[model samples]
Target chain A: MSDGPAIETRGVTRVFESRKGFLFREKTRTEALKGVDLVVERGAIFGLLGPNGAGKTTFTKILSTLLLPTSGTALVLGHSVTKETAWLRPRMGLVLGGERGLYNRVSGRENLRYFADLYGVPIAERERRIGEVLERVGLTDAADRRTEEYSRGMKQKLHIARGILHRPEILFLDEPTIGLDPKSARETRKLIRSLVSDGVTIFLTTHYMFEAEELCPRIAILSRGRIVARDTLDGLRTLVGGDRTFEVEAYGFEDREIESLRHLPGVSKVASEEYGPATRLTMRVRTRETTLDDVRGLLPGHPELAVRERRTSLEDVYLDLVEEEAT
Target chain B: MAASAPAYTRARSTVASLRLAVLQFMADPQWLIPSMIAPVIFGLVSFELFRGYGPYFLIYAILGAGMMSMWGQTLYGSGWATGQDRNFGTLEPTIQSPTPYLYVVLGRVLWNVVSGLFGGLIVYAVVVGAAGQPPALANPLASIALFVFVMLTLAAIGVVFAAFYVYTRYAGFIQNIGEFAFYVGTGCMFPVVLLPFAVTPIALVFPPTWALDALRYVAIPGYTGFGWGLWGDVAGAVASTAVYLAIAGLIFRRVERQVLAKGNLSDY
Candidate 1:
């Protein structure tokens, strides 16, 4: 691999077209990606988070050379996905981990062995590498069993085992931990982190906010086929609102009272939700300029009031940014 | 950091996937029963129909039924494997690998030739049992070589049609629709002479038409297909097979690009 960002895209766009109707067969086009520009440094765990149709998988597919971009450009390890795939494919690994990607009748080891040869893993070390990957994924015991009998999590682990079997320089993992139990997901995250420490750049996409926050040092949020935000959690925290959120609950609060809370010093935004008889005002505060006492004081008329302060979670940040884009 | 491995070689991928195909077949070998049902019936029916054609009738039955079975496995085997990859969602990763997809495909084709031989045996057993005797060949060794050659020709055609599967996930449907057309066009059940004069040119396009004709000329004493004799039939089969092999190599590159461009490699 040449020297450059592990992954980079310049306004990359992908449009998918399909024909419908029996007689007319009108063509309908769906733009899966819209001019996405991003960069991922080498050896870092970069995460992509998105809604179901937000095109996270499409971006991963383009970078991994599985699909061609309709316009713009995507490069992996300084090689264009479109023209330099021959140079890029061997150095890149993709784990689209799901129930579908494995041969049901073959053993898990056989699946990895097949990919090892396809990726040109050295013949002398092929078996050892397959064994090691199976062990790393905690699948050594199940390696010889036919994959058809393996559970979804085991099949997912097999997907990961095949992905890292060749020791690629950059790995594209599209929701690698999806569908696994918490313990398996944690182990998979640990494996991903270990891969990063071993100098493999990881481009991860996941719906699990905590997973991304725990594993990815930097992340990009894709909303509506465009990247709404890309930065460290703190950076995104600032972009969405702040690193601190204050939750205030009461029987009720007036619109003017809510507006006053939104205008308070250090308050970036205020959102309200009703749960049965009570209302909760979620205030994103950037600094200590606003406190729980201040929120409580603004709604002093309510006898039943509960106020607390907590650090903004990644989920809060994600919803803030994605909701903003939705509006 | 782990040391990255080198690029894949065509030979190793071929062997590895060929082994995979056999392992998978062994794992769920029952599919073999369904695949043979049609050919076995065709063989038994051909035996009854050809029983009155004299001593040469047995050779006719064997050639007809054996070629039919080989035609199914050798031609549909690789395409079926590709379609299976699409369903299993394994096609995405396999296509993503550095090894050109054709090598992986060639592995399946080669394995199919082996399994296709098993198919031929099934048909042969059915026909021979129905005849209550083995077919007498004018030149048994020559006929054997020609039978294997016919299989290779079918394999060549198979390799090319396999490209169709790699090109689209719906290839199985398309191939299914064209299957009987192919059987008739390739003259798998009989000689190309039986096809219409206008369709003869289309029949000659497939390597099996020439090859099966060549095998019959060797196995039957008075068989004179196309009046070209055995050597001409052999030469025609060789040229057509070579052409098909060359097309297989070229078609894959184009199909790979087409599928990638359409973003439909995973559409199944």
Candidate 2:
């Protein structure tokens, strides 16, 4: 159907079987991806965020056709990845494992041309495109230089250039800015945005939450081979919404006095802990509704008490979600 | 980047890729020098040490150096290339491109062929030409055809070896074994006939031995004093090397399938 996503995986799983020891080793199995289902619309910048060893690379490999899923199916640009990989490979671009995704012996231009050939770029048009990509990545002058001579940021740019050489409809960029300086990282992000604007569907994976928040319209948080959450930034932000907690420092407060604050309306739970000679009271409430109104009514009774409110940010929500899942 | 254009643009790209590989070879003085120098040293040492066997010894020694050059370059260059791929993380990107895997494999093999030719020629110019017993193929065109056949067989072997290297992702372990095969099976250190006849079958399994035999037969045609009919043996070696090439291709495919199934293609 015309409605098919640019990239989709349904119940995909990958298991690695390896042997241990030297002479008398037993077989070992590692489950890298487990029943993961993902969908990215055409031209969408989809972010896949996970901790290291959380199967982000595994998922990228599967989508990029470098790997086969043990138990499920994936489609890239409407091509079935497992069954028709040869058909899918030409239209898909992949930059996996950062800067090492290059032929070090070849120059930047040569690397691009090599990929262009792999993609079946017409012979007549390859030269101009090669020049274009090199210039675009600002590696034109260094295009003739061996990749071994490239700086880390230069290598990353070359990697990006190689991935887009074929003008693929979908791109899988794994840790694209992994080792880049801040300026280069910003440049890479801008280039990624431009690629997206030109109808290129980008499937990006990174550990940088802020990058995801800035670039990806939708993100899936992965941990332990499972996707914990997949939603738009605002939608994910709402997932952790409920109560704002405040540490109310008072001129004079006792544990019994903190208990009095908890008894107020809209207060869900209250805990008091000692800091030096003072009692720090943390309260969890039930609404975005001003806790100050309740605190005002309660604090006036204790004339010496000071009231303050602390709301949970997205980072706190993410940590809490991951921690909660771990337990 | 430039404006996007039409499809079907690939031939120039493939050539460009080849050019890049060649340029890289020229720049790496370390590999370039050793790849050429080692064969010359082998040729000179063998020529000086053994002269009692007459022209047979000198001519066949040159053939041995030739086989060593081809095998050395193919194995060493390809092995180092495989290592560089692992180090640079270039494998995944190339795999993701629209190019067929076979084309990429061929591009790599072609690079090895170029390196072999350059290195072999250097050794030939030094040892055979200087000794005044330079090789002249009796059936020059036929010898060319046979040389290609033998090289393809060896290349297939290289591919199987390269695939194993890819799967293991070990740095230069495959090259070490390749270096061992060069010395023992290809008769680089000594004539293959000097190896026990019992080992002939095993040595014949390696393309370099057939390659050496074919080259010797071509280079030294008339003097079959040992009762070995030169051309007949050359034809037989060609046929068997073809068979070995087919087997190597099958092994390469099998290894590729295993690596894909295991999902360790990018392990390094």
Candidate 3:
């Protein structure tokens, strides 16, 4: 076992040069990844969550040694990411985006065998591992089919198989379930869990929060090339600083009632919406010993009110973080 | 078997990649099918028209058609295939793998050569049987040797063209140029003997030209029958093919490095 984290980055930056035209006069520089530091513990399912164009792919590329960072340093399994790529590449498997990473002309079996060889997998063990991965990814039946005829999901599964061919110490899956049906997406998540159980660490970048909530034990929210939050799902919930919000609908239409609820001691933010025949009010309040007690006390005054407390979820926390950043 | 050390892991991986390349070619019979048909089409319609001139015409057509098959299917075919791979970004996973880049390139080039050989044999059969003027082997063993050298040379040429496709982004242009060169240099319609002495020397420098004459001496009807010995043509073609192969190999390595350094391999 390694003493440090499976993946670690310190002030890593990846800058890409955009050269335009034949003469090469017009040049622009875009910083895809800017001085970012992160760490992933061994055997942990880590999620990198970010909006589109948030440099998640750039960060993943640098960490996987596919692209060299302009500045800063990253280490994968105690190997310098920038230097010693040949030694480092075999130990870390990567699944890039889209179906483009695979050879369409070969059968899935042959494709896997070819990649296995590139990873230096022994011949005797190659077939065994290939069989295991194909079955694990539910591609055993289609293994002999040419990849050109494979559907998007099948190609992605094969991509995953190729990534883990050499049993790399750490796996980097970028948008692994980007274009998959619900069933396939769930299966992919299950596969990730299975890999983690096998002691293979996973560092994944996904835009789907449910994926993060369902798969990643610890998640990092990357916004604008920086990590705004990195914690367990439960920790993120606490960090958002919002408690269970109740949306109450009452038949009685009264402005004074709304005013009184807004002035409650624990209520931090109040939002109101129309609920058919009644008014639906949502309050984001700090949880105190008497918070529910306070709501209960106010509810009795309005006889027509039907009070229901809504459970705060990961999505709610995510929206809160996004809205806070917007302000 | 007892457990062995991991020294041969890389070699096994290279072989596996080569197998994958072969699998890719086999998976798409459409690619090979057309290459097989092109040579026959040229042989039937074009080669027959040139037969009245001399035995040299029939032999030249046969050899030219054979070279065309290899140059078109192997060299130009590899160019188009590699271009497609680059456009699709399939090279990313390949380059990222631990296998040396040279093995990757060689595996792909070898696949082209295999396809080219198949195409050459099919064309050779059509030209010899259909034209009713098959060229005899000047020295059967030497002819076989020349075929090996010539195919290797053509495969190397294919590597160079594949590299060029990475930069041009239009591999079809290479295929067109290759087809034209096949017709002109190999004297498929006009034998180099019809050209002036100065032009003959220049045309003879092309691999296909040398290959056409060599095949004619051994496989076709003209050269060995006319006092030009089989060994002379075989040796000359072999030397020229060797030189072409060496240059092609250098170009393949150079372009590969440039493509990797510029990160243009993934460019569509």
Every model's DockQ: 0.73, 0.49, 0.30
Q: Each prediction's Cα lDDT score?
A: 0.87, 0.69, 0.72
Worst lDDT 10-window in candidate 3 chain A: A284-293
Docking tier of model 2: it is acceptable
Task: Please give, for residues A221-282, the per-residue lDDT of candidate 2 as tens digits.
Answer: 88788888888876665565434766676655655666777776656656566766666676
* Strongest candidate by TM-score: 1
Superior candidate under lDDT, 2 versus 3: 3
TM-score sort, best first: 1, 2, 3
Model 1 stretches astray by more than 4 angstroms: B1-5, B34-40
Candidate structures ordered by lDDT, highest first: 1, 3, 2
Residue-wise C-alpha lDDT for candidate 1, range B1-268, written one tens digit per residue:
4444475799999998899998988889676664578679878878887889887888878777777777778788778888888888999999999988899988998888887777777878888888788888899899888888888988898888789888877788888898889897887776778778887888888888899888888888888888898989899999999999889899999988888888888878
Residue B264 miss distance in model 3 (angstroms): 5.4
Q: Write the per-residue lDDT of candidate 3 for residues A173-280, one digit (tens) a residue.
A: 999999899988888888888998878889999989889888898988877777777888778767775566766777654677777787887666666777777777
DockQ of 1: 0.73
Candidate 1 recovers a fraction of native contacts equal to 0.81
How well does candidate 2 score on lDDT at residue A178?
88
